[model samples]
Target: MIVDESIARPIAASEAHTIEADVAIVGAGLAGSLARAVLVRAGYRVVLIDKRTVPPDEFRVEKIGGRQLDLIRQLGFINDLEAVGAPYNRVLNIRDGKVVDISVGQAFGLSYASLVGMARGLLSDPTSFLIDQVTGISCSDDRQQLELASGKRVTSRLVILATGMASPLAYSLGIKRRMLAERHSVSFGFTIARPDNAPFEFDALTAYGERTADGVDYLSLFPIADGMRANLFMFRDPTDPIMRELRRDTKRTLLRLMPGLQRYLGDFDVVGQVQSWVMDLSVVEGHLQPGVVLIGDAFQTNCPAAGTGVSRLLVDVERLCTDHVPRWLETEGMGADKIAQFYSDQGKLAADRHSLDMARFRQALTLNNDARWSARRKLHFLRRMITHRVDRIHPGWVTRVRGALR
Candidate 1:
């Protein structure tokens, strides 16, 4: 594993004026950093560039579990992830003050900055990272060039845009974002602590919204290094008055919206700043160009409420770095024909489609008051509650039945 390599050795300032590599990635976030690590370990000379020296304290994805953890292990970074993140194996799921089901699995919680930092630290050659804004980019089937803000230039055989939701550079290349849904969902992030600074009774907890009128999907509370981190996902309008109230008086607003949470939380106060994001579900058009490729949020945005953002980006990184890029590098040119193979990959296409579908399903389940959806909403919780009860009564019975059906 790359983690066993010596610590990163940064390049001198003088040697960075002109750089060359087989691949030049424009963003050093999780997606870009992971790509650089994978390519470098495969013996490809890769350069990763970002304007910020340190990843900003952003309120992005804060937890990884399930398929996300599987992908991390597949990339050989599970040990590194366990080192930096706080892990929990059980999550008590509840709705309207009653237990729905208990989710048992390995998961980790950490801030976005720390997560990106872990990815960046995987590169033994820190010199491959450039801290300068890209002023312009020009690409062709044979090669690509990038102009930097510090008067440096980077020449490479391929360029990858993992710039997240920002699209200025992609726009310059005639690529545009096509909004599928505007103001599709809103999310809130913050930390909470008990009055006495004591630990909560459960390992982790998820409280689902009791009423459709509240517009809330769920409130997830998990343990980070500092304290319990809270992520509240909603389908409400971003401009609603409740949004302001949630920011100003978080604890009170949360209790009023989901009264069942009070019994579980037991007099907790909101700590630090409350960060919120309004997401517009979108994807890029006209991105199939020579010498350039889009991945992660640079290519598409997902509804945070659905919890599919990390899953989609991890799929993008695994498929591009492991399967597509190597095959493209074996050939002479980085043409659209080669780049098209990645977009058409079965695994990539399935992930992208599943993200969009999950986003729409979460919104309908949370806010739709139609007769059919209402019945489904009830059955959803009821089914889980019944299964949980049966599991307690007959240990391993549910697992045996599910395995037989599969």
Candidate 2:
């Protein structure tokens, strides 16, 4: 099925009542909820369905900033972001017990559950969100139907699958995930606090691996609403004994791995349970079909260390919800031809490519020990050190230079 990207089917308000909504979004994760907000605010009837009324306190993407903030602002949710997230601006990057560089930018920290809840709250009419699991889905060019676990059914002109990885719904529709990298990265998430309940010297910090053999990428510490959140990313086998050691003795294991972190963080204790995730880089196959579109982890999985999950999903939501869905609804049929426009969109394609590229880049940059990579690794940190020195001599000089170039 081939559809012209230039054609936009005229909007017909009378036809919106024929179905439950102009679009039915399945899954209420960050991607799904944001899509619903965009479509509904644009005057389209949208039904957002999910199994859990509240998103679980999962160890998903817990921070947002940089390009992610730019997109969220474009969608008119920057104020909402301020409402729910802890804002921070400085990230001290360190390696081998020495400062490498400092990253200064606007960033926010929050739990995945709270982020999703805030996004879902953006929809004006709360009734549009359905709290039910999708048991089955049937798709066609003209209409799509959803069978819920609670015996409720929904029909819409278009179906947006924002279900995260492990989606039986997408698999049932003949969509399969092509694993780009299996068990590519192992990440640990937990909260930490000073034993005396005192504030740390730095607001946010990142410590890179001193030795490549440790397979450590970096350990990022930042502020969340609960406490100081720490995310440790590594390129190592999940089945390795170190995984158990990290879970049992997080403080000692972390210090042994990145001893430099000790100076910046003075005597802290893990506040709660440690949550770990073994991420597999993957993309959806056989998804450009009629009546359905996949977004977020439903379409692709990202490496946490790469920090591209939120950016990629934001691109998916913006391109599909803001551009493609409205046009598809106007034309009457949700065929592959219409869906292909989104798949071929230059912006979406670039974001997906950058995600995969960064996943491989981070893994190789951390673990690859070839002569070429060895030199590349040295140059990487050396460049950062040089830049830091230059910036120290003239504060905000780097920022001004980059801004002028832009």
Candidate 3:
């Protein structure tokens, strides 16, 4: 799925006059950028507004695969993704010092900033992007207006709130983030390389905690352009001393948490700054207003360990940009009824519900100590191990049987 490679550059300082468009998306992150690309190519006068033209390096989704990859392909950016990301075909999964299973699939890894850049680069018209902070917004059924920090005005028929988590802009419009779960999960992002700067034994690997009490869900190691990136997801208190130890003596504490890692990974050095994030499971309330719609993290937050963030955002982008937004644009006024159609979209609803459900499921799987859950945890891995053994004995048998059943 390839589209036009040419991109419109960011708005120049002199060209930052009044911005006008059919849709004004506030936030130049993944959601906003992707939406702008789609709308602009569809011949809609779209303006993407954000504070930063160059997104800073941040600890966000560094790798994407499975349904995430499929969604990107559907969005017609698979070729662009291939150009910017490092791809791997196999992931060796281990737990309790033994192989659990081998996941064979396509995946890609890169920095979050690079991913955003790639999205922004999809713009066919450079002037469609405005690198300015939004200070105020006024929405109505017929039209919407925005006041920027630079005293410029942007008027559009519709507004998209994709400012992600912690948006004062959304709060200004009386949209509140209801915390479903606070400090739901803690995650770590960093890079690791062999002492000799060589590649690791595997192209990609994942090691789960031996004991549930350790609070670690898993350590996922994958190849990025820079090096092997490590994303450690855990269900632990952010203030715990173990968190400090992880930041200070990352390699040591990581090995201590998953001793089995050493046998497979040997000795590796953390090559870059250690980044961390504490995620809260939350959803937006009072967002069903005229002329404005919430998307991505602006609509709901996801548990990183669950690995549903990409899927959720992709669904938001795909359903809203490809389906609902176009239909709304063809009509007269952007009202609450029109906006509700997107929130009520079956695919969007399923993605949103699944993201929340997976968040809770992952947390429970990692931290629950109940007798039933403990038994479930054992059976989960046991099933994987058994299936892996069976597959090893007869290659492609699992695929044949599963496909036939389907």
Candidate 4:
């Protein structure tokens, strides 16, 4: 069912000037592609449109773990994910050149492109995908229409916008993004390997910032199919000279920022391009409408440092596709009232709220030098270190005590 992009043909090539479907998903990114697969497997006709046949190498969510893994399993895409991602079960957490704890869990590392590719490949019918741009959308309470640049049109009962941040298509529909925090965080992504091509001392590692002034949240190193991948997150100004240094002289500037990395990483060189992204924390307004709904970054944007983007999108996908869409389709119309239900869904609301909350929490924890925050930061790490030591000594004592307390 994995359609090769090289041999993939547009649905328009079949001499069909118009297509009809139960759902039309715009933007074949992670969210749209996954939504299409879910709906298709559920016996709904889905038409997915995107400009690119192949997902370009982009600096986006490059790893999946924690609740994200659980959501993927719940959506039945874990096997597809496992086929494309490299797995790591332990991450050595360190601060100030010392071991704070070891986080044991299942996580996968892969390029965002491969991740999206895997999702798109889950479609049993390759002809459902359209490699073209959406020029216009006309929506009503009963049905919606999409005008593609290829001069073809698609009519569907429901439309899902997964076009991501700064979507001109959403803006054209009068859906505006309200900036909660502009330039909220800066993130760097790249691969690294020792000169001798040897693996690192640990299966995975996380080096926390040594000083609040450094504005570094953490540097996470994990395994990908290509090599060891590194993600450096910071709360500093995107325009700072350090940003330039990190890109130009990655290893040296990285070592200078967190000297402790030298011990664990040893002598390593950054492989391939160093991709950087400055994120803005924002959410959509005026999105409630007939025949349409927004999901993923189209609805809200998340701070990369918070690691909540994937979880939020997965929640959006799960709630809308599995719970909301099926029921909505069975009913008469796709109205603002019906669309409002998804926006008000408790699970979606919580995920959206949690992503923003964690965004602010991470920024404050990294750069807030106020006496109260400083003390709080110290206590946070100290608590983790203590718990890790205790767990190591007594094994299941912490788990048992936590269970009893709960």
Per-residue lDDT of candidate 1, residues 1-406 (tens digit): 2321222223235366777778899999999999999888877777899999999899998999999999999999999899999999999999999999999999999999999999999966767888889999999999899999989988888999999998799999999999999999999999999889999999999999999999999999999999999999999999999999999999999999999988888978999999999999999999999999999999999999898889999999999999898888876999999999999999999999999999999999999999999999999999999999999999988899999999
Model 1 stretches astray by more than 4 angstroms: 1-16
Clashing residue pairs in candidate 3 are 8-126
For model 3, the run of ten residues with the poorest summed lDDT: 1-10
Per-structure clash totals for the candidates: 0, 0, 1, 0
Model 3 lDDT, residue 141, Cα: 97
Candidate 2: lDDT of 81?
Answer: 95
Clashing pairs in 4: none
* Candidate 2 structure quality by residue, lDDT tens digits, 1-406: 2333333222333224223667889989899999998887777777888889778889998999999999999989999999999999999999998999989899999999899889989866766787888898999988899888777678878899999998999999999999888999999999999988899998899999989989999999899998899999999999999999999999999999988888889889998999999999888899989989999999999999999999999999999988887677666677899989999999999999999999999999999999999999999999999989998999888889999999
Best-to-worst ranking by TM-score: 1, 4, 3, 2
How many clashes (backbone atoms < 3 Å, residues ≥3 apart in a chain or on different chains) does model 4 have?
0
Ranking by lDDT: 1, 4, 3, 2
Which digits, one per residue and each the tens of the lDDT, describe model 3 over residues 1-406?
A: 2222222223334355666678889999988898988877766777898999698788998999999999999999999999999999899999988999999999999999999999999865677887788999999999999999888898888999999998998999999989999999999999998889866789899998788899999999999999999999999999999999999999999999999999998878988799999999999999999999999999999999999998999999999998888788776999999999999999999999999999888888888999999999999999999999999999888999999999
The TM-score values for the models, in the order shown, are: 0.96, 0.94, 0.96, 0.96
Residue 160's C-alpha lDDT in candidate 1? 96
The C-alpha stretches of model 4 lying farther than 4 A from their native spots are 1-13
Q: Tens digit of lDDT per residue, candidate 4, span 97-208?
A: 9999999999999999999999999976777898999999999999999999989999889999999996888888899999899999999998999999988889899999
